[model samples]
Target: MEVQSAGKETYRAKTSKGEATRQKLLDVAEEIFGAKGYFHTSVVDITQRAGVAQGTFYVYFPGKQHIFRELVEELSHNLRREIQIAVNGAAGRKEKEIRGFAAFFDYVRKHRNLYRIVQEAEFVDPALYKWYYRRLAEGYVKGLQEAMDRGEFRRLDPEAVAYCLMGMGEFLGMRWVLWEKKDVPEEAFRAAMELIMGGLEKRD
Candidate 1:
């Protein structure tokens, strides 16, 4: 009985260690992929940086492509959630849009490497590109449609509006925040909000 109990404890300890190792691999991969584009990063690089055997990486991911996909999916989910929270917490539609932009800029600032990985993946992986933008556009459309229905804005094609607003925000963010290596000021976000609101405002 004692031997059996010892065996069970050993198994539990091994499982815990395995989980920790997997997390470490993912963390290292995020940094590497962020710094080096997805196409440029390699499995060897990941294993070396993770300080694990090459075979150990296979235990958690089939290949580098799998890891890239996983990272993109994770980032996409996080961005969606952040945008949702920002929009939901606002008192008005205009405020919500501004907050949404702010949240996205903040996220990019915190995970600039991850952002680069995402951008690289868009060129290398069409599925990932479609998945990320589709989800993002859907969220924006839902928010805009809801606001319009509530009389916060004029009625317009939600899909078109979503695409336009997101495109504008993305370009502004990439130029000012990402390319310029500057933080996204609140005033910048407010300016974006004003431009969007002006276009969508209802005429009396």
Candidate 2:
């Protein structure tokens, strides 16, 4: 029994170490991929940049494509979480929409590299792009649907509304964070949200 327990502990330790190594590789890979792009980055580049063995990279990620996919998925997850937090904290539909937009734009500004990677993935891999957009669209749809159900917003197709909102957010994020060399001010995002919700809000 003692030997079995000790062996399990050793396995767990090794597993944890492997996961750490994998994450390190991914971190470096994301940086390089974002700077150099998916087509230009190689496994050797990641391993060298990450200070890990080439074989180690293969163990965690099959290749550059796999790493790109993982990066996209991770970014998507983070974006979703940020938006959810912002929306959940708001007191009303208008506030929720503003908060959601703020959270997304803030995230993009702070994580510009990751955002660029996401944009590249959209062009390089259609399937991954679809998956990313689907998740984003679903989040927006749910938020709009909630507002409509609460009688806080006018009647409309949640999915369509969500897409429009997301499109506007995406373009704003890209312009201020990705293409333009500056931080997006909070007021800018707030104004954009106001414009979007201006026509959509339910009048008392």
lDDT of each: 0.78, 0.78
Q: Per-residue alpha-carbon lDDT of model 2 for 1-204, expressed as tens digits?
A: 111112222222257789798779768977898889888888999999889989878776666777777777777788889889877867988888777877887888767786678778777777777778887898788878888999989989889988888888888878887788566666877678778778789988
Error (Å) of candidate 2 at residue 71 is: 0.8
In order, what is each prediction's RMSD in angstroms? 8.4, 7.2
Q: Whose TM-score is greatest here?
A: 2
Worst 10 residues of 2 by lDDT: 1-10
Model 1 vs. true fold: TM: 0.84
